[model samples]
Target: MKFKALWITETAEGKFERSIIERSIDDLPAGEVLIRVKYSSLNYKDALSATGNKGITKKFPHTPGIDAAGVVELSRSEHFGTGDEVIVTGYDLGMNTSGGYGQFIRVPASWVVKKPEAFTLKECMTIGTAGFTAATALHKMELLGQNPEQGPIVVTGSTGGVGSLAVAILSTAGYEVIAVSGKQNAWEYLQHLGASRMENREWVNDQSGKALLKPQWSGAIDTVGGNTLVTLLKGCKLEGAVACTGLVGSPKLEGTVYPFILNGVSLIGVGSAEMPMSTKLKIWDKLSGQWNCREKMNAIAKEVSLEELKNTYIDTILKGNVMGRIVVNVEA
Candidate 1:
């Protein structure tokens, strides 16, 4: 059956064009399950794919949504059956394969997870891939023995999806959170999301030539790379860890190994793109339970239709002006 979708194509001149178009499940790439998507979400990676970034999407006329939550319309795998609520994130769903911008999606069973009972289809999109990444980062930190007693945890890119969720989960779990963001107006919003305090983006920038600075945060969840990651490493407490993700600032890092050798600060690279289903399910369980941030997730997310998604969020997020997550209702 034909369904509504947001289609992106490349012009002969090699530019990208986007619009709402009609699609069909039969046209989607072959997989083990067919999902009638209820909700999708706009993410930085989606914006990149929509804008014709080959790194995120190589082919033209693609559907770009990294996060999808819906019900299984058809399932060939014994692990999943028809009429089940499910979610698909990362694992090439929206990268090289057809993704969630369409009303229906067909993906590998390995790319699917049973929607946590605590979250509805909409709330799952609310947490989406961004929240999942944050949870993975925190989980790694906790596994490494990083705790509140060491010192406060700093969340860079604090107003964006991953950073915001990091603040919420960390604070909810009794950790002191220092939200560092450039959006001054979001200070109050960050506080409501459980940030114990707030700092301007300046905290992530350091120009001093010192090999290491005074230890401040016990650990850090860094969403911006480049100098920000370097700064976080330089100021991390002894034996503390930094969960590094996102390169909105830049991909380059030019810092000495002083923090690693002397302070024992370990750099933990967190990437959801290629995570295993076993680890993904474990994190989703926590997100549906104690690590879940319903209030913050709902408050921080803006709901938009597939049409509104293209008309708005793509540019806002690409320019780094996004305040929080953008939820897209594919059914709308």
Candidate 2:
């Protein structure tokens, strides 16, 4: 059967032109399972790949979407079967393989997880990679001995998908959350997502190159790296930890080791793309049940059809003007 997909073809000038193309299972990359994708979600990495970032995607005429959820149409492994609902994220789905920006996807069964009972296909995509990353960061921080009694936890890029979900989960777990963002218009929205207070992006930026700043936050989930991460490293309380993810700002970190040595601060790097399947399933279960925040998820997600995604990808995400998550209904 043939299905529709948003294909990115390279022009002679090396730019990409997106168009809906008819594709069949034969066109999909070889895999152990074939999934009829119901929904997919956007991420920064997807934006980069769609724009022909060689570091992310080496080949053109590729589909770009990092996360997807749907029912299995065919399977070659005992772990999954036809008609089973499942989700696929990370592990090369959108990088070097045909990804979720289509009505269907073929992926190795090892990369698939049974969809949690708490969420439908749409809801699962609403959470997608962003929510999973947030949950994983929180879990890592807790494992590293972070607790609510310590003090307020700060979340940078609070308006973005990962940061927004981090605020909701932390607050729902009885922790005080301070949401930091550069978007002045999103302060109220962040508060609605359970942030106890809203802070400007400046709070996480130390322009003086201070080796150590006064301890402010008990812990932090930093989605904006670069100067923001440097500031977070310096301001973390004694024995505190910060989960560093995303290089939206800059990949370089120019900071001293005084925070780690003097304050015993630990920086945990979060990579949701290449985690083990067991860990991914565990986090997905938590997000579907105990850590679930329906209100906040709805607040941060804007549902759009696949047709609308062209402009969304080119304008909102590529230009850094997007806020929250954009869930794509592939069959819409």
For TM-score, the strongest prediction is 1
* Residue 13 in candidate 1, Cα distance off native in Å: 1.2
Q: Please provide TM-scores, in order, for all candidate models, with all chains considered together.
A: 0.98, 0.98
Model 2, 1-332: lDDT tens digits are 89998888899998888888888879898889999999999888888888889999999889989899999999998999999999998889988899898999999988999988988888888888888888999988988999999999999988887888899999988899999988889877888889989999888888986789889899999988999998998999999999997887889888888989999999998999998877888888778777889877887789888789986554587666778889998998
Model 1 scores a TM of 0.98
Identify the runs in model 2 with alpha carbons over 4 angstroms from their true place.
none
Model 1: how far residue 3 lies from native, Å: 0.8
- Give the range where candidate 1 is weakest over 10 consecutive residues by summed lDDT: 272-281
Per-residue lDDT for 142 in model 2?
89
Write down the lDDT that model 2 would get. Answer: 0.88
CA-lDDT, candidates in order: 0.90, 0.88
